[model samples]
Target: MTRPTALSVALSLSLPLAAHAAPDAAVVPDTTRDIDRVQVTATRTERAVSDVAATVDVIDREQMDRHLVQDLKDLVRYEPGLSVTSSATRFGLNGIRIRGLQGNRVRIQTDGIAMPTSFDIGAFSNANRNFTDLDTLKRVEIVRGPASSLYGSDALGGVVAFVTKDPADYLKDGKDSYVGLKFGYDGQWKGLLGGATGAFGGEHWSGLVNVNHRQGQETVNKGDVRVDNDRRTAPNPQDRDGRSVLAKLVYAPSDTQRFRLTAERNEDTTDTDVLSAISTAVPTPRAPLTSGMKAHDTQDRTRLSLAHEIDALDQPFADSLYWQVYTQNSQTRQQTDEKRTDGSRRHRVFSFDQRAYGLQAQLNKAFTTGSVDHALTYGFEGTRTEIRQKRDGYQVSSTGVVSTTVTPDAFPVRDFPITTTTELGLYAQDEMRLAGGKLSLVPGVRVDRYELKPDVDSIFAQDNPGLAVAQLKKTSVSPKLGMVWRFADQWSLFAGYAHGFRSPPYNDVNIGLTNVAFGYTAIANPDLKPETSDGYELGLRFIAPAAYVSLSGYYNDYKDFIESNVNTGRNAQGLIVFQSQNIADARIYGAEMKAGVEFGELSPALKGWALRSAVAWSRGDNRTDDEPLDSVDPLRGTLGLSYDADAWGVELAGTFVQRKKRLPPPAVQTNPNAPAASVYQPAGYGVLDLMAHWNFAPGATFNVGVFNLADKRYIEWSAITPGLITDRTLSDRFSSPGRTLSASLAVSW
Candidate 1:
């Protein structure tokens, strides 16, 4: 996993382009630079990004400040067949694996609603979703693979949207703008504030607030230093603190009415520690010296939208109409532990709260077709969800009290269970123009009907007894075909195909489970079925105005893929239960290539220099037990080189990940000491990152970075173990953190 010679391809085709090189519809309101006319909403409409045909990756805000990207798995790296995983306690047990199938099969959005809260609950791999907060992001669209025909049923490994900001475009010439901050070092401390506001009479407002703190220290592997019991544990050098807020308000009293308001809030707390399995020089009898794994999260969202451009609908079919309403509230508290013997210790706690609501409406118009040329659109949407869960368990000792206490009948208790879903969709799209305008075609179709209802809970209490209702209708008809062939004058070539569906998981009908094949207890399965996927893509672009290069390929096909099994023995409270199934198909295929060069002929000592790089490769499987698909990652790539002027700029990037061969699960084949282990393959590492940015004025800006850079020592996969180590730190693992450095300062006033 190290081959890019020829002097790194002539130093990546001789860097250049850090600014200047826009114009294709202009309108780019700085959200961290590095843009190529970016625009996308995964086809709900909003084109551009080379007229979409799929394969889109826009991380604007100037490449998230040259890659000091905070959160969302460092903004999916240079994205291209995404991959990210973490569990064993590390702030909400991170997870994301496009083209490889990740929990819930990828489907996250914002500004387009649709927050399903992991279907039937269960997925506290720490507490999913990890709510976003990159200072109220203004851009981030990764429509890679699969899209469930424009978003339906988790989209099967594809779709990630997070777009925000538009408070009248955050005023600038009338005043009101700001930024403030500190940075990372030693313990990775962090802090940054925000601001934006300008209109008063015509009514327009923008607001943002941010806070991120990190306490570093523990997280070592190939050099020891990773303790969890027997001392050393207190959020260890991995404590985190966060707070984010965004507010926007807009009003356009005339010119056909317009009003909008948005609000968002985020809170975070993540403590780490989960290493146990022995070693650090032995010591394993009555374990428990200290164990940890904690998480706390909070999310809040609000949105209201309205738009009009009527002249009595101008009578001609339609002119415009739009409406939106969104609401969200999420809360989670999680914990996990291990440290027993007699000294005692065994914990697991997860508390949940979720709420989601959405409503949407759309319309647009323009006409003509004979000689080609048109514009038309349509849409409809509705959504609702509510969930609440509480679980407490313990088995303490070693002076910790609580000998044992875990009941809700020891398992089964779905209290605040209320699921009432509704969705009805009807869509149409048209945008045709031919030769004269250099060619174009956009097709669309949507016919959705999703309904859910599963009240369950009746009396909640397990030992095997009670609710298992079942009913969550489904109906789909997704169709979208696209093409944009502009033969030159900025070149173009796009392609698309879509179809998605998902239903059957409203808590999977009261989640019944109580095994005991040979002795007693039995009850599981409540007619589960419903999960489909199909997504396609094609692309080729060379948009001018600066420079752009794109290439794409994607494929996905999944059907009834859900698994869980371990009907090994006991039950009736004796333990060992687990059953959940429905599997038989899965596939993911891929290819993605990106290139950017923005040299309006740099000279002034390499003016705002420009140069960019991207690379992606994918291969997913599980074609009904064909293997290779428990956590996919076969290749990942990134390359960057930069230098700019204006105030200051610097960037040097390099990242590559490859190596995966660990797949164990399926009830470990009845343990027999579980032989055949080493699929132990992890030997693809490349790290080198450095960044710097400065502006000091005009909305202010300052950023600094340094990550990895030679202090290398790898191991990011090998049968999970981000805590609960000991096989000599599991032959010492986890590594990937050193040579740290960070800095940031911002002001937009």
Candidate 2:
């Protein structure tokens, strides 16, 4: 027992929309710029990505379109320091892991509004990351380290903000209206998708709308094998469909003021036909066990927002200000129909709704006191969230038939109760210039207060004096500092320090229940401490007109890591379960480097040839328990070579992931006879990908890509690192898709 000191935890060149504001939804089709990609979230003000001291990555529209962006899951694969747990056949975004921390530790947002992070209740909670259409995004901004400096609370792991498209981005220069369309198909995913964007503008007003439709079949491993068993819960041949719409109206009343309103809706549904949706006839006394299952899962999300911005204020202290109000609502529903061993039908319906509303105001002022240039940004946010969940099952007749009338009180009570939470945040960042224009420093701080009050249903009481009780509230204040030194021409060094925190979630405190008759009980701990992390990073950047490169190293110290431990007790079900608790402290450290160079700039003989590469490696350990953090990302690298001509371009890309031996599986808490399954094995594999595209004209293009060119089958790290309790056997998990081909056509003007 010795604790390693804390610190924890890049891409590209020539990207269109490189200089777009972080929060101001990007507007563009395609155009390449030098090193001046502008971003606002880094400092709460407009600044190029090159000028920011902290690590920020921009996934431009060009890169996104090149990859045929599908969802958040698709976005994280190429980026370093981040991992998303979503399978190709999965319905919704599962979870995002950063710096070895998963779930609520990461913060997801669209524009400036916070998106709901995932939370599990009992053993039945579903993954929920509010929906967003990739077709509507201009770019994605990722802050790789602690972000509690600017955004409060859940910023412990980092931030992923989706920047959407706006009207001004699509309107033709000389025309009153503009329209764009895209269509694509992927054989691996069996996916067919189409999208359209239309915008119209007048002298002072602009309106835009984007619509997208997606449908797909389940992806499979080599030989088209469907790997569903009792443990994985996934049904082979899952069918999926998703539709999204985004509309916006923007008006500038005067040169100094502007107003905007936006409405967005996204809905997705997946259906699965299962052979064993329910457990079959068993040796136990409970006869007529469910033997087959079929389910339909659906998610619908809607957001309405209004914003007002003043470029310049009448008062001296308020140089510029912006404020907004927004409401977001989401619903997830699952319907399961099972056939019992005795040949009866059981219909189950489970649904949950989450509604959130918030108000935010930000103001910034710049002033000079002597030789130092100073800019200060201050903001406050207040948000309220309400959640309700209900579930019921009805019995049917013989031959696995139907039910027309409702069955009264046929199933168990609510699995999770109604809950409400209120969060308030205040933050400020000061960017000050020192040593003239050679050095810049940013000091920032944030305070967050979270209050939760749950109204548990009466189901908790077996007879009376149930385990329902109201408990704890938490608050945290974090401070951060960052500096950038432009010591040489086109070269700069940067370093930063930040404190991050995450308060205990509501469900963790209130989900206490027991079934004595069934032999299982899960008690909740109301007094849980918030998780905290100390992060430090140092890096360098070289920016030039024709090429760019960045290298960074980081370390992070984490305390009060949240985890649940299970005991050797049998419940009504044969398996053992656990409750949430603060188990241990951990540390993560790593280095990353990325570069893009166009050889034409240095040598004419290499004209039209460009090369890009990114490499990363990291390690983590549980300081208290003396074990390696299982989710640490292994050594990975990507290389690409491309040649661009007047009308056509071709590129060859390769990816390699090293086999990791770091974290061995700890003994399972359940029965030993069950045998160990997919532990932290982290099998390493590599594949080659190819892409070619033709630019038919300025506004039209056709692109084709072949993935997994070698047809090598491998399991991804994200899927199995976080093991599935739903698995009932000792077997392999889902494998990556096989060799697949896809082509897309995009047009804009």
Estimate, for each residue in 1-749, the C-alpha lDDT of model 1 and write its tens digit: 01122222221222100000111212122422333446555555556567666776667655665466666657776665676665432443355667666656677776666543542223232456757666456566777666655555666567777775454344445545534443534212333333332333344334434344444334333435446543322223445555565655555566555555666666666555444332234435533333333333333333333322232356466776666766777777666565544456656566666676767776667788688888777767666766666555566667878744432124333423455667676777777777787777777777778777655454343433653445656677877777778887777878877766666555444444332332322234456566667777777878564557787777777777655432335555575444445665876777877776666454455555667777777766767766656555667678777777767778788888776543433322224675533334557788887888877676566787877767787655522532124233343344445566766565543
Worst 10 residues of 1 by lDDT: 14-23
TM-score of each: 0.33, 0.89
Off by over 4 Å in 2: 1-36, 87-92, 121-125, 223-235, 275-290, 395-412, 457-465, 565-579, 672-680, 721-733
TM-score computed on alpha carbons, candidate 2: 0.89
> Which candidate gets the maximum TM-score versus the true structure?
2
Model 2: per-residue Cα lDDT over 1-749, one tens digit each: 12111100000000001112423324443435323566676677888888888777777777677666676756765666677765333343576777666666777788788876564332123647747777778877777877876787788888877778877767655667988899998776689999998889888898999999999976555433334334442336678899999999989888777788989999988887653233422624344555667778888889999988888796787788888899999888877776666667777667778899999999888999899999888888889998777655677766545553222222444544577889898988898998878999999999999888877656434321355556568889999999999999989999999999888776566654443333444556677788888999999999886789888999999888765433435545563434567767888999988788888888889888888788878899887778877777778888888887877788888888887678644434345686665444546899888888788988898888888899886666766534442242322435676788888898887
- Judged by whole-model lDDT over C-alpha atoms, candidate 1 comes out at 0.56
Clashes of 1: 31
